[model samples]
Target chain A: MYRYDEFDRKFLAERVAQYRDQVRRRLAGQLSEDEFRSLRLMNGLYLQLHAYMLRISIPYGTLSSAQLRGLAEVARRWDKGYGHFTTRQNIQFNWIKLEETPDILAHLAAVQLHGIQTSGNSFRNITTDPFAGVAGDEIEDPRPYCEIVRQWAALHPEFSFLPRKFKIAINAADADRAAVKIHDLGLYLRRSDRGEIGFAVTVGGGLGRTPILAQTVRDFVPRRELLAYISACLRVYNQYGRRDNLFKSRIKILVQALGIEKMRQEVEDEYAAMGDEREALALPDEAVAAMQAQFAPPAYADAAGDDAELAQAAASEPDFARWIERNTRPHKQAGHASVVISLKPVGRPTGDCSASQMRTVADLADELSFGEVRVTHDQNLVLPHVRKSALYDLWLRLGAGDLATPNIGLASDIIACPGLDYCGLATARSIPVAQALAVHLAGREAAIGPLQIKISGCINACGHHHVGHIGILGLEKNGAESYQITVGGSDGEQAALGGIIGPAVAAHEITATVDRLIDAYLRLRRDGEQFPDTYRRVGLAPFKEALYVAR
Target chain B: MDDPTFKLVTGNRLRDGAVVYFASAGIWTPRIDDARLVEEKDGAALLAEAQAGPPPHPAVGPALIDAVRDGDRVVPATLREKIRASGPTVAYRAA
Candidate 1:
């Protein structure tokens, strides 16, 4: 919904042109493969198995119907019939040709979308809550701030090449949907005691070869000094963070080496040195106003017959009611609902959307709701502002297009990376493992309850297995795909890295092993306890003991 | 531990021999494969090949390039527009 202004438009266009030239030079043998990899990663291109996978960013998971349509067109013309929406709210085309990439970028530029910072050991795509503007528990919309941060972080000279990839997530609500606590930098918009907007900044959170929760560096940073504070933090990390050892390069490693208190003190000292610089970085009211204006909520009509229709639908179609219960949520506008389209079916690849489905999603975004959709980090689509009265009609259309699925946060819904299927770094096939687990959980959807099962192809933690209530990491042992399960991982308000349950399970036994683990959980859980609550109450020992029952 | 019998593609489209990048006008011409294919130290060849595809135009958002070569497969991390401009065809055309 944030339209590209002239500055934003020109910035993106120039970047595309630069990349085009870079690409041409690389082809001409002026640049080598190793040299080109970093550049390409900065642009969100990955060479996966079978074909080249291109990841397009959906900044903070927001997209207009036009942009969505643009994505669909890209998918239809260049990739297979669909594109996979990623856990980072980005879209990936599984198949692409090397030569046609420039034209692809040119096409994206026409629609004001680029693939900058989607990858590489640099500051990556900045993510935020999908329900940024509409969520009821929000302080103020964080989208404007996210946009500001996006502009500042886009090729910032100082932090461009860091020790490792950096991720920043922002949240404006009491409920954390952006997984703020598990990022390199997490910003929470909160009103200070003086009634001024400020940010509660956290640092050192990341999941990769090593996973760590970010420590709260500053409980409250004045909103006016947001960018300056961030710059200071980055400066500290960039200076002291490891560069020699790729294994321990993340800011998280630095935070771990230095206790949270010391890290906090360091960031604070850096902030102090920044002094007047913070004031200069304060976004002018006009700029904030202009950015804020780009995200004005659409005019919403009264919820004339929303309740009645919803009630009728619930009574008439239990499945539809369950779907609404899982997928639909309150919108800022009256008589409207924010609908989430789940990419996870009973046994399809997680985050995999065919090009035709991409087009359908775009068309539906234009026709049914507003011409806008948001992708969630959990690998789902959000029609951010949709009229509640049109929920049924929208569902019908989406169902026709195969984009409508009831599961949103259910067990069947999974978050997975392109493991062995595409990623060369993958030890095991995450998508298949996810599919198998989904099959195991299929018939018992009710029993499954609300579970976040994330599968990462490897320790890079692209699938965010570290935060799943049931986290499964695929590893290679004796040249065979093996899985390591972690319990009690959470990415919500109280985020924590999951602890490994026990010995690794063979890949073929993954689904069965997970089933056993779930059964163990079901038995151990107290009345009305979620998986996270159960794991928290009893710890990993009980689960481990149950898992190795035979041994 | 690397899989043998591999060729490069621009984005995901397969290429013959070792061509790495796409030139202007959105055309991907064949280029000599980097020695890294035989020797791993020169990672630039692989990286350059992946990053060698056409860049996005200014009208598009900023272009970020990334590549993943899983054995014979070559994937460009930045490849939606190319897919959109051309119809869905997995294999590359003969140069």
Candidate 2:
């Protein structure tokens, strides 16, 4: 885990103090709503449907046991006794009081955490693969580069007020676990033919009112020039990105309007201009090395013998076996595995973890993993490293806390935003939809296999519905809540936006509609193909016919 | 066309950000039943009063919501308004 230095600590302390004064002024009625709006957003505070929401950044989805415990404390003391982990790898407290926000921020700062750059038209939280370092397929850990980007983007004067909120994602593994293609800037770390480390940069991909898959801008830029190249891209966007229209402000719109070739040329021109002073902008090898050193792999005991015991335990316990199959992934280490704690259990709102659950996970991290936890893009938690031998014990403990549902990538693992329930921008409710779908699919998840069901309250795509195998977008039609279903979207290695299947369905009928779609998939799928694969091969005709046709 | 005459004014309290409705006696209450119902002719005046509450009142986006009176209680006509008035339709633990 990366430890904050004295400089980081001091920076966060000053930021907390500044926000404290801002909150005080706002509460005293000295700052009008208009005046305090941007200021509060700068501190990652927002006035939502029912209450103030505080979005706290978990940089690159990485968290230490101490930080997790602090979050639990905040949840218990300041707001409600729970927090919602968002798709951006950040956690939001929905019931924050405006007056107590500063104190909560202070508490977070004490744990070397802050909500800086979590909102506004500034750089949002930097997200990466949850299995950053431990994944066997990873070429290099992306967290160090994520950290580098986080520091560079923090309070960047030039890019503070961009055309729209900018999001950056980095992925080092072959699988693209970070959902890179949907980010404003997607960096794929790779090794060149000559074994030099570099990045494949993609730009202009995002989901909101308009969803577009990012196009590659550069195939290879050396690691040292990563910052310069990113700065060049931002400069181009800052110069020409739309500011007149809120809906057309994202860089994806600009990229679409200007074309990728033109966009690439413009970025290349700016990059070349920066290259003239490359020594100043390019991160030095020593600096990169220093950052890399902070994310060095934790010491691992040589325990290849533990796998035999793990196998024996899995054979004896069916539930443990199922959990191992679904919730655990192969770690880079020989005797260790990365375990996913499912937050989307049936009958519960997806991504919500109570204070007690948070503390339990923290304790589990201390005892099992290396005192580290990772929040995934799918609103799940990850223990990046756990001994294969200790899987049974960990699974049992997780079960006790309602965290072990054995449905990591299954249908029950739904991604849902707090829709009309709490979000002011939502046109319809999402949590209820997700809950209903989870219950409907609970018994048939194993049969359906790995399917990503993402629900968004509005077109903002906070739940990443655009990339789901079955995307449910909630909208208001005529005075009632309705849903629009999309099919075949994915945010994996081959990212694609889902196509809307049919007209809007009533909220109450969504589960049955989804059931019809799944039944179509089941009927059409050849062999054991997943939903996305089957949908890709067969197209949406079968599902569309099944859905729209009379019973 | 939907009747826009029957309405109620609502906004979140500035101090705690709680969802509140403009009620009788110029007070904001967390209950929809406490909201003062107004006809289309009186909606503008009721909204003005709600927005012109004493200092440290609701901070953002105070507006009149189309509603209807059911027995002694006022019910929001639109789904969005209904959700705003009674919290989420689903079970949510965030008090």
Candidate 3:
């Protein structure tokens, strides 16, 4: 983890003090609600349907044990004893008092965390692969680059107020775990033919309202010119992106209006125009080296590849075996595995972690893995450096804390947004629907196998329903809650938006509709096919017929 | 057409961010039953009045909610509002 320098510490302290004064003024009636709205949003505060929501950025989804403990303390003291980790790898406290927000930010600063750039029309938290350093197939760990981007984008004066909120994601792994293709700007870290490190940059990919996968704008930019190229891309967007219409304000819309080729040309021209000044923006080799050194892989013990103790435990306990298969991923380092501590337990709202659970996971991270935790884009926690031998003991600890639910990549492991429950923009209830579906499919999850069910309350696509294998979008039709289903969506190497299967079903019929669709997939799927693969192979006709046909 | 008359003035409390309703005797209460249901024509006036006075009570973005009287209790007409009035539809906290 990157420790804060004196400059970083001072910046956070000043920001907290500034926000504290702003909150005071707003509460004292010196600042009107209209005047204070943007200021609050800039600091990651939003007044939602039922209460205020404070989104705290967990930069690149990386947290040390002490930081996780700090978040647990925040949840216990300031919130309703829990926090919701979001798809953006951020955590949101839904019930927040206006007066307590400054104090909360101060507490976060003590842990070297801040809510800055988590909201507003600014660069949001830069995301990367959760298994960045440990993944076997990775070209290089993307966290150093993510950290560099984070530092550069944090309240950049010129780009602070863009046409809309901008997001950047980087992936160095062969497998796209970070969902980089669906970001405003996506970077793939690669080595050129000459063996020099560079980036493959994609621009204008997003999911909300108009979901578009990013187009590759630059084939490769060397490590030195990385920041300059990114600056050029932002410059083009800031200059041309629509400001009048909020709906058409994102860089995606700009890319659509001006073809990707034209947009690339414009960015290239801007880069050229900067001349010698652009070189100043480019990060020097020493700076890159320093950042990379900070993110160096943890020291590993010279142990045998196969652990006899782990093998014995697995053979003896079927439950442990199931958990190991479902919750753990192969690591680059021998005898080490990345364990996913599932936040999705049956019948609970997805992505929510209680104060005690947070503390427990923090302790587990310290004990079993390195004293670091990674938050997945799917709203799960990752112990990225767990030893194979410690799997059973870690499982027992996690099970006791209600974190070891062997349902990773299963039907019950649904990703859902805080729909009508918290968001004012939501037209329907997403959490309840997700809960109902999880419970309905709890027994059949193993048989169903690796089906992603994402439910978004509205078209904002906060839950990423657009890219779910079984996407459910909640809508308001006439005066009733209706759910529109989309199938064949995926957020992977081959990313594609789901197509709607049939007419919007009523809230009560959503579960049954999903059940029918699953039954159809099971019947039509070939051997070893996932739901998405089967859906893509058979198309929507079979599933649509199954869901809509009268019983 | 959406019913405008059967409305309840709702806002979150500034001090604690609790969902609150503008009730009778010009007070803000967390209980929905204590809410004063106003006619469509009077809704705007009542909402304005509720938002006019306080820094502590009904803080920001106070608006009139389309609601109906279910026996003696005031209930939000929209599903979204219902979820807001009550807590989360699903179990929000861990067991």
TM-score of each: 0.85, 0.97, 0.97
TM-score of 1: 0.85
Query: Which ten-residue region of model 3 chain A has the weakest summed lDDT?
Result: A300-309
- The best-first sequence of candidates by lDDT reads 2, 3, 1
The digit string of per-residue lDDT tens for model 1 on A488-539 reads 9999998878999888988787777778878888888888898889988899
Encode model 3's per-residue lDDT on A1-551: one tens digit a residue. 78999999999999999999998998787787788888888888888877789998999999999999999988899888999999999999988888899999999999998888888898998998999899999999899999999988988999999999999999998889988889999999999999999999999999988999999999999989999999999999999999999999999999999999999999999999999978789889899999999998888775465577788889999999999999999988888899998999998889999999999999988887779899998999999998898888899989998899999999989999989888988988888898899999999999988999999999999899999999999999998989999999999888888989988999899888888888898899999888778877888888878876845
Instruction: Let me know the TM-score candidate 3 reaches against the reference structure.
Output: 0.97
- How large is the interface RMSD of candidate 1? 11.6
| Preferred candidate (lDDT higher): 1 or 3 | 3
TM-score of each model's B chain? Answer: 0.25, 0.80, 0.83
| Candidate 1 wrong stretches, greater than 4 Å | B1-95
What DockQ number belongs to candidate 2? Answer: 0.58
Can you give the DockQ of every candidate in the order shown?
A: 0.06, 0.58, 0.58
Q: Which docking category, incorrect, acceptable, medium or high, applies to candidate 1?
A: incorrect
List ranges where model 3 is wrong by over 4 Å: B1-5, B24-26, B54-58
User: Which digits, one per residue and each the tens of the lDDT, describe model 2 over residues A320-375?
Assistant: 99999999999999999999999987979999998999999999999989899999
Error of 2 at A194 (Å): 0.7
Colliding pairs, model 3: B5-B40
Clashes of each: 74, 0, 1
